[model samples]
Target: MPQSPPTISPTFRLATQIEAILYLKGQPLSLDAIADCAGCDRETAEDALIELMDDYAHRDSALEVVEMPSGYSLQLRSSFQNLIQNLVPAELGTGALRTLAAIALKNPLLQTELIELRGSSAYQQVQELVELGLVRKRRQAEGRSFWLEVTEKFHQYFEVDELSLILAQSPKHNGTAAITEEE
Candidate 1:
């Protein structure tokens, strides 16, 4: 007899899609983010998350979906976590990383400009980056907004000497970020 592929119900498929996003992100994502990435609506994404969590609860798996104060993520089930100790590097939340990327790409970017580029949330991410020593912030001598830039720690931590490769590969976010502009 020939082998047959296992069939997945639409709900189960949606759950798997959410699973992929959570795994790839390695960070918590809200219902809206999950839905946007999954090509579904918030309600549908919520249902999918529930289904996925239920599936994990019933399976003998090392990983499980969890809800954090920030949002939803996939992580090693509590009991199995010791197996991954020191395996994963400390990570920034997705939002903070995105803000850092914007600042790095636009070296010596202005805080005001960063806010415009990354939305109001950039304020918090910038503060976090500064506290981590990956970014530096200083009062603008000529303006109210501060100046922002990546620190040596950033280059070392990310292990890249030149950003030209990254520059060549990325397009502006939604074609709106002024990453190509000459300041």
Candidate 2:
């Protein structure tokens, strides 16, 4: 008779299944969703989640399992943020990205100046960037227009010093026109 393969326990299988689901989703998942996807009960899924979290905490892995009100997600540890940023850039639309680049290159830019450089569509782009938490707007003292600046989130996301290095190599950074438009 052929030797039979050893069977894995239900708890171990559920934990591995939950880890795979979280990895594939690349986003937070609710306990209900995890249980449904893993074909297990909520209690089983919770046990698996806790096990996975403990596993990650005890391992030499660069990733961590986080539980938020929205759900649970696997994410890189904060210490690896600078390294990860160089590998994976933010996923912004072209218009919003261009506006972000312009803002970063010329920080503390006035709203009127941005409009002058990129046209009225900049208003919508700025709104989108602000919503994304990559840009901040403050009212100018002398005018109704706002002054736009990149936020700390932007720096953390993109590695601001790396941006400066890239910008320095670009020819556009040379002799860039001054924002002379009246506020």
Candidate 3:
């Protein structure tokens, strides 16, 4: 006889699991997709989804799970919008953002290739990015071309680390309190 798939945990509803998966994937998933994943009917899945939504209705969090007409997705919560905006240096303008976006999307791209893709202004923008410590230059032995990589600081600012590992590294109130106690 064929073995059945393992049962899902009851601690959090199937929809909550779906939400966690969506957040980790950083993309939206349809009801059918979520139901298929959670091994439940659409109605039960949606009911669980509603309950999960209620759980996240109003509280401070970096991200929130939301359901759109097409699918469900996890996104940065609006309350932390300012925090995100502050993370990036104000000196970096739209041109810099576009340049960074291009570089990040096509990482390890050559400086010449980036210039060709982003135009002549990219050279100056790249220099600026280098000064800002957002991008680094790496030599590509294949063609002796230099490529840019995002720095650890950039990752911290973005809270990427698969889930705010940056925040985890920072000194928290409890940590400071312990230090004071030792003193």
TM-score of structure candidate 1: 0.48
Q: On a 0 to 1 TM-score scale, where does candidate 2 land against the true structure?
A: 0.49
| TM agreement with the true structure for every prediction | 0.48, 0.49, 0.45
Q: Cα deviation in Å at residue 175, candidate 3?
A: 44
Higher-TM-score candidate among 2 and 3? 2
Per-residue alpha-carbon lDDT of candidate 2 for residues 43-123, written as tens digits (9 for 90 to 100): 988998999999999999998999989999988888899985577756777888888888877787898988988889999
Highest lDDT scorer: 1
lDDT of each residue in 72-179, candidate 1, tens digit only: 989988897666644653479999999998888877889999888789998989989998888999899997989898988898889977665666655744332445
Instruction: Give candidate 3's error at residue 28 in angstroms.
Output: 1.1
- What is the alpha-carbon lDDT of model 2 when measured against the actual structure? 0.81
The better-scoring model by TM-score among 1 and 3 is 1
Candidate 1 local distance difference test against the native:
0.83
- Show model 1 residue runs off by greater than 4 Å: 1-89, 164-178
Candidate 3 lDDT, 77-177, residue by residue in tens: 77777976577454568998899867765555689888878899998998888887778998887887797877776667655653233333556524333
User: lDDT of all the models against the reference?
Assistant: 0.83, 0.81, 0.72
